[model samples]
Target: MNDKKKKSDTNSSAENVEQHLQELEKADYERLYYSQEQTFSADELARSINEQRLTELMAKSDEFLKSLNSELEDFDD
Candidate 1:
């Protein structure tokens, strides 16, 4: 009888754990779905701004290098 009781208790505990895990998974799925829906446009805007800034920096760097090359050529002469 004692052994049977222990077995029953273990099975009950396992079922409870399984139920909790399922709940957590459901919550996670819902959270991810909503978060993506909310952030998609904001994410795109952020990416566009970052790309524009990168392009501007590249242009400035190229101009600086060209000017430095000209200065070096003057020094060589």
Candidate 2:
């Protein structure tokens, strides 16, 4: 009886995981996460803005976004 209960629990867990994955795949994630470029006017803004290193931050954020999607793909497998 205990063996049967364990098997039943395993199957239920697998089914729940599969259902969650299906729901995840159905989401419009791209539209939900779309990022448009931002622009600011004026050649001379705050010195702090110039020193913020936006270029390096953008590069790092892009890499982070790519890794996020790759992590989801890993879960799919």
lDDT winner among the candidates?
1
Colliding pairs, model 1: none
The regions of model 1 sitting more than 4 angstroms off are 1-11, 40-77
TM-score of 1: 0.39
Model 2, residue 11: displacement in angstroms? 72
lDDT of 2 at 8: 71
lDDT (Cα, tens digit) per residue for candidate 1, span 1-77? 99988877778777978989999999999999998887457778787677877899999999999999999999999
